[model samples]
Target: MSTFLTLLRRDCAQLLLGGRRGGALLPVLFFLAVAMLYPFAVGPDAPLLARTGGGVIWVAALLAAILPLDRLIEPDLELGLFDQFALRGISEEGVVAVRVLAHWLSFGPPLMLAALPASALVGIDGAQLRLIEWGLLAGTPGLAALGVLVAAITAGLRGGAALGGLLVIPLAVPLLVFGAGSLSAGGEAGLALTGAVSLVLLAITPFAGAAAIKSSRG
Candidate 1:
């Protein structure tokens, strides 16, 4: 338990407080930038913006999740940090689990916070903004876990960053469908389904990431 706490702290520092690189500030800025640009491109049709803004937010969040992918696992792998963890009897699963938690904490909450201004920019009302926030809360965990999975898989490969982005798009469809789909329906069912998917991804991430890390070492 102590070791896990220590590792979690280390992961958080590396991923959340490493200044400009991993403070999670960058992804929030990128997400808001996307939301900000979307309105101008689509013109000031308030009705159109209001109707589609939530979905646009979802897309921005999804892309923002990808922004940190290449750095997630590669930094540790390259520094042989995983090797040290293994030597200390820290299983890859344990490392990956903590990493998943740290990853989500790093960007997920901030993205949620940033969504408020984004909602205003896109012209969503208070109610719609609430739904979008709810949807993101349910779904960002899955997106975080998905990012870790992709990062682990592509950590050491050539052109891995590009490959990771491409790989993430298809896998992210379900989250996009259920999460972004929820806003249109104005129902809890879609949010519930999104959470279910998130739980599944969270459950599998440790093992899958461990496997991918091991495979990369070979």
Candidate 2:
């Protein structure tokens, strides 16, 4: 438990202070602002806003998710923390898990908070707002897992941003499809199933990322 707290503290320090000023918050805010812009760009037709809402939110979420992977593995690799953890008694699996928790806290919650206003702008229903929140809650762990895996795979690459998106976006398609599809369908069972699928994706991503990271690191 202490180790977990230590890892969270370490990650927060890096996010809040280690990079360029406002390192973590900047990307999150950028996504929020961009999401807000879409309604204006598309004009104020109600149907259009409602139709585009889910896609806008999902795509913006995906883009926002991309920003963090740039620094994800680099910090540990540069600071020798990765090797230190491996040497000291932390399993790579444990390290990855803790980092995911930290990453989610730093990135995911802020993105979700930012989503609230955008959700309103996009004309999401109250029930749909809850569904979107649930989908995001369940789905974002997968995003984090994908980030760690891609960050590990592109650990030493200069073009990691390009590579990370290439690797992650395709994998995230199901999340977008089902997430948006649920709200479009507008049935109780549809929403419930969508949330269920999202939970399944969350369940699957960590193990897959864990396998990928172990393979890449080993």
Candidate 3:
């Protein structure tokens, strides 16, 4: 427990420092802005806007989750920081888990915030807004975990981005399906349950990714 806390703190420190380096927050913000344009481009029909907002927000979240992965892990691996983590008495699994958590924290909350205004623009009700937030919260962490694993595997490979995308897209399918589909339905509990599944999927990702990274590192 203490070790995990220490690792989480260390990873948080590294990510916070990275923020000072600039360009870190830009991609998620850009994604949020672009997602808002979809409704305006479709024009000011309330039904259409409401219908599309949830799907657009979910899709935008997935893309935003993927955006930072390549850059996030590549720099660390290239500069030998990942290797340093392994050598510093931290378990490789812990290193990978902390990295995933950091990436998710950096990318997820801003994307969530950015989604709110877009949700309003799209005429999302309070209930749907809550659902969208719930879905994103549950789904993005899984995406982040998959991102970490794929980023690590493709770290030094040529065409790594393409390879990483291929690996992650299949894993992301369930998240996309349940997340977006749940929004269209009327029942709150059913939608919430579906959202819960997505969250569980997100929670499970780091464990699998950590094991894979550990095996690969060995």
Candidate 3 residue lDDT tens string, 1-218: 78778877766665544545443476567676767788769998889888887888877777766766666566766677656767877666667777788877777777778778878767899989988887777677777777887787777678887788777778777778877877877544545555565566556655665555555455
Q: What TM-score does each of the candidates earn?
A: 0.97, 0.85, 0.82
Model 1 quality (TM-score): 0.97
Model 3: lowest-lDDT 10 consecutive positions: 15-24
lDDT of 2 by residue, 66-144 (tens): 7878777766776777677767776666667676776777777877887788888778778778777777776677677
The prediction achieving the highest lDDT against the true structure is 1
> Which segments of candidate 3 are over 4 A away from where they belong?
1-6, 13-17, 20-24, 187-218
Among these predictions, the greatest TM-score belongs to: 1
Which segments of model 2 are wrong by more than 4 Å? Answer: 16-21, 186-218
Question: How does residue 172 of candidate 1 score in lDDT?
Answer: 93
